[model samples]
Target: RRNDPINDALWDVYIARSTDGGTTFSANVQLNDTSFVTPSNGRLGEYLGLAVDSSNAYVAFTSSISDLPLGDVYFDEIANSDIPEPGSAILIACGVLALLRRRRRK
Candidate 1:
């Protein structure tokens, strides 16, 4: 997102994401805002990039002002699966132990 001033100056910019495919978005937090000091009169903007791999996804963006020519860039990565809940590791360990015992019995 971006806000442009009347004179074409950029003021501020923000970026956000949702791990659940946009069902719910994270806060519209400011990733970069050149006009942070004087927000009301300044402008803002953002450029977003997205990529995915078999196990992970990534999002990136940059925000800046017209005069600055360079903006802060940000990136985030998400795993394909939600983080396992508590006790999940114990269950996995038990399952592996059971398999090992079965193989030893044979």
Candidate 2:
């Protein structure tokens, strides 16, 4: 990223996925479509936060745009075909079967 005078050096948010138990990682994809300017007053933070649901990964970070004087928080989510846990899959199957049986009784 190139340095900037008005805003801090231009920054971008990226994300990567690992499927083979951290053996290999997917290509880094920039999450933020727009610009992500760093805070000028002080350090933004030590690390970024990431949360993974059953189907998607969510990331949060600090970013300051060109218009605002202060920095603001930003977040993004990316979807992936995550494998469902065995217990969860069984629960879903049971729920579907119960619904079907109730409909048949009607």
Candidate 3:
């Protein structure tokens, strides 16, 4: 989830694992090598796909990176062991509750 009021094009792909049944998540780990700007139609991009097996996760997504002006699909592989354990707590907005934003100071 992004809350930046500036630089709307600073789109980056990330993955955060939830260990407690989605009640909390590990800090997001960036999956993309470069930042990009997706289409401005309130969508991150097209063909954002995920395939998971017993030991790893695979991701395929699109990006229009700064260096690569032409958009391209990128693939990433993450080993299940590489995902960090959730040490702290942060709720990722999901489902019908996403529209209800809240504030919490650290």
Best by lDDT: 3
The sequence of per-residue lDDT tens digits that candidate 2 reaches over residues 13-99 is: 655555444454555556666766457764544335566655666667777754667767777665654322110111011001110
In order, the Cα lDDT scores of the candidates are 0.36, 0.48, 0.56
lDDT of 3 by residue, 1-106 (tens): 2533475446667766665656766776777666666644546534476655556767777667645655677787888667677712222121112111123358
Model 2 local distance difference test score: 0.48
Off by over 4 Å in 3: 1-5, 40-42, 66-70, 87-106
TM-score order, best first, reads 3, 2, 1
How many angstroms is residue 67 displaced in model 1 relative to the true structure, after the best TM-score fit?
A: 15
- Tell me the TM-score of each prediction against the true structure: 0.31, 0.59, 0.66
Per residue, candidate 1 scores C-alpha lDDT tens digits across 1-106 of 1354464444343333344433544454443434422224243222445455455545454434344545455575645353231101110110011100111135
- Against the true structure, candidate 3 reaches a TM-score of 0.66
Q: How far off is residue 69 in model 2, in Å?
A: 1.2
What is the lDDT, from 0 to 100, of the residue 27 in candidate 1?
A: 50
